[model samples]
Target: MSLLAQLKILVVDDTTTSRLLLRDALETIGFRNISVAANGEEAMKMMTTSPCHFIISDMNMPKMDGLQLLKAVRTHKVFARTPFMILTGNADRNVLEEGRKLGLNNYLNKPFTPEDLKKALEAVVGRLQ
Candidate 1:
């Protein structure tokens, strides 16, 4: 649908498979500007150098983490209100609560479908008429 046309998206995940899967999903949904980060540390670096319109991150990673990244983003005035979505396998209540408090835009559990991703993006970007 090209709902994400020209919209920069930063996708952070530790697993190559997961990263590729998400990237492909976004592409299939017509997202043109998609970037990938292996972990939160890499994501932070990328975010600093190249700002993005949206960020979809995994909750767990080797260096830094989704929550840490979220906190950093919130503290940065430039990215404070940028849309951040957590895509995780872990569904811990505490984690979700923390994410909510940190101003996370949305949360999606693992094994999600293309529709799930589309819905989340729509929620953040608003449904394209």
Candidate 2:
């Protein structure tokens, strides 16, 4: 089995389209164990129930934003070392810097391609292959 296939990834985004797009990209890269959450709150709940190896979360969400999720994960000993990748349409340096401070593995802007997602995932978890 591929190394990537062993990883259980959690994708958190408010939009159904974004979630589906991300899932397709991940599947294309040979990731089989993938899960989705619409917001940080759901993500957290899922984490408590079944922690994931990696997380891809949108920076902006209605219930709980990515930064807040990052903070919450960081505080939890079980999830502190899990790889986190932030997805955002906003290019605000301040927001990015804040995520950096909170220990995000990487960040990908909106409208990213499959290659962009692959690169971000590789940067966090090492070579996908």
Candidate 3:
């Protein structure tokens, strides 16, 4: 089996359209087990029970954002080292630096194509295949 097929990924985005787009892109890249959350809060709750091998989250969200989620995830022993990618329309240097400090694995700028997603995933967890 391809390595991507065995990995479970969590995708968190505030917009439903973005989530669907991300899901479709992930499927195209050979990721079968994809879980989605509408917000950081929802994603955090899901992580308590269903851990993911990788995480792709929107940088800005209500009720908790990507940075907040990253901090929370890092506190937990089980998910501290899980590869994490932040998706953002605003590639703010400060935010990127902060994410880096908190241990983000990669970042994908918004309005990205499937190829962008593939590249981000590749950077975070090696080649999807």
lDDT of 2 by residue, 1-129 (tens): 778868999999999999999999999888999999999999999999999999999999998999999999999998898999999897689998998999988999889988999998888878888
Model 1 lowest lDDT segment of ten:
1-10
Comparing 1 and 2 by TM-score, which wins?
2
Question: Between which residue pairs do clashes occur in model 3?
Answer: none
**CA lDDT of each candidate?**
0.90, 0.93, 0.91
Model 2, residue 128: C-alpha shift (Å): 0.7
| lDDT winner | 2
TM-score of each: 0.94, 0.97, 0.97
**Clash pairs detected, candidate 1:** none
Find the 10 residues in a row with the least total lDDT in model 3. 120-129
Model 1 residue 39 lDDT score: 92
The runs of at least 3 residues in candidate 2 whose Cα sits more than 4 Å from the true structure, single-residue gaps closed, are: none
- lDDT score for candidate 1 against the true structure: 0.90
Regions of model 1 farther than 4 Å from truth: 1-3
